[model samples]
Target: MTGKPKLYYFDGRGKMESIRWLFAAAGIEFEEEFLETREQYEKLLQDGDLLFQQVPMVEIDGMKMVQSRAILSYIAGKHNLYGKDLKERALIDMYVEGTTDLMTLIIMYPFSSAEDKEKKRAVIIQKATNRYFPVYEKILKDHGQDFLVGNQFSWADVHLLEAILMVEEKKSDVLSEFPHLQAFKARISNIPTVKTFLEPGSQRKPVPDDKYVKTVKRVLQMSF
Candidate 1:
């Protein structure tokens, strides 16, 4: 594999930023391809591998990688960025999966009508607050530390912590209800590597809502 991979991303804040942060934290060298329009994005898609044909995909050693989480996992594993050991890796996976679930909801909200979006966001937040909070609390309690896993940092911590920041932008004090999670998010944010990555002008816009038909409201109905 090449020392530096080719990274495809958009220019606004969205799902891809976490991957960008992941690579930056790992100290990986990568060339970023930024697209600003449909034509440019489509042109690259035509040449991208057929499996997913998606951006935020990483091209490493001439191999086309797709799916955001998959790309994060691959990079984390390759760079020894997962965790300290098997147990820690498992914890990281748990946090990553939960964060993914939360992000998926956020991605769907912006595409719906304002009414539907408001309603959907409320439902998502309610469920997450009631059902998901305790689970995460237990995780923090189990770990007995600020990190989701071992002493060192991992992809999960970066992903969840960043997601919390994004969510809080739209929903104030979302993590306040869960003190452990609140502390956890703050702890990850304080890391020098993560702190730098979270700084301004580093994120790519999320996949456009117009591109995906069946608006956010539709997804919310099915999701919640």
Candidate 2:
């Protein structure tokens, strides 16, 4: 067996960051190979390494996987982060879809120049905080627990933390109105496996940076 899973992606965290944090929260060891240039990624895609011809792929037990959410659900199932039963699974799935709704906007910010990205970012920031985040806040508040599904921590909470960080980066005041969400983020971050991913010097980023400057235009339409 592979000692650990192998993940391939652009250097920027992008979709892979949440997967990384999931692995950490699950206490799994994995290795990563980052794309240094667009040419490297294209060559891998052309070679048929990526099934959908996109990145944030993982190799587990010699079988390759694509789509970040699929990988996450797989890992959560294997690692017990998924929750205790079918009822919790239903709720987890609902929140995962919600997080994806917020994530789609965050991932689109880098497809253009700085000015256009900011314009879209501002609009997204407003909608995410005002409209979407409150839904999560109420879920947390209604549950009256440290997590989204059941009384135990679930992958839904981990995924929400990822979305929260992205919104917080754009506007530091993103969580100002959502105390339950703020507390939810704190619980996710307090996990030993998750803490490293959020700590200073970690590769986690709210948006693509200098390393991904050449890579964004290609991944802009990514559904993963």
Candidate 3:
């Protein structure tokens, strides 16, 4: 019998959720540990005696891996989820990197005030929407592929879909303005694997509660 995968994650809408969705879509049985507070995470670390100093670590048959993107790529390769060919795989990686860059900016907007965030959002739009969008639009147009890769689903598509959702949530109608990206997101979201993984009741959005936000706010206040 094969050993199950063990995954550690925080409760929030972030990188870890993407990996969780992948595992769920792949029909892989594994342990998911969701920590909502620093105290809970510390206790879990003590109890498990884990080696890593971060959440979203994965232990595959006792071999531990960290870094969300690295974990996603590793599992994608192992599970044949990187599309049909080497070129397709490269394209998948390309989009994954692109999405990561955008998401990094999007997440920061929420922790900041509206004035600062609006300025940042404008810059992101000028660079990401104008420059990056064209690059992605050309890729989707040339690839003639439903997914970011060849004719199949890949981690890249999932990451891109997540990025699109986040951008929408942050009040950017970049997708509507760019039809190709909109198409890409819609196509990826409808994948049989993705659909099954996202089935109702399988998982819940893990946005942090007000108390957790307040704690972080207090800590930042002290630091600054």
| C-alpha lDDT of all candidate models, in order | 0.69, 0.80, 0.69
Instruction: Give the per-residue lDDT digits (tens) of candidate 1, residues 1-224.
Output: 44688876554345566777788777665777665556665676676553565556678866778788788888899877798778878878887888788777876576577669778878777766776666778888886976667766778777777667667766787777788888887787778766666677544334445543333223223353
lDDT digits (tens) for residues 1-224 of candidate 2: 55799989867767788888788778788888877666777787888988988778899977789988789999999989887988888889988988888888877676556668778888878888777898989887886877788878789888888888888878888898899988888888988878887777654554677557565554443332
Q: What TM-score, computed on C-alpha atoms, does each candidate reach?
A: 0.79, 0.88, 0.79
lDDT of 3 by residue, 67-165 (tens): 787888888888888877788788788878887888777655556565686888786677677766677788788877776676677787777777677
Candidate 3 positional error at 216, Å: 6.4
Q: Lowest summed-lDDT stretch of 10 residues in model 3?
A: 215-224
Q: If the candidates were sorted by their TM-score against the true structure, best first, what order would they fall in?
A: 2, 1, 3
Better of 1 and 2 by lDDT: 2
Which candidate gets the maximum TM-score versus the true structure?
2
lDDT-based ranking, best first?
2, 1, 3
Q: Backbone clash tally for model 2?
A: 0
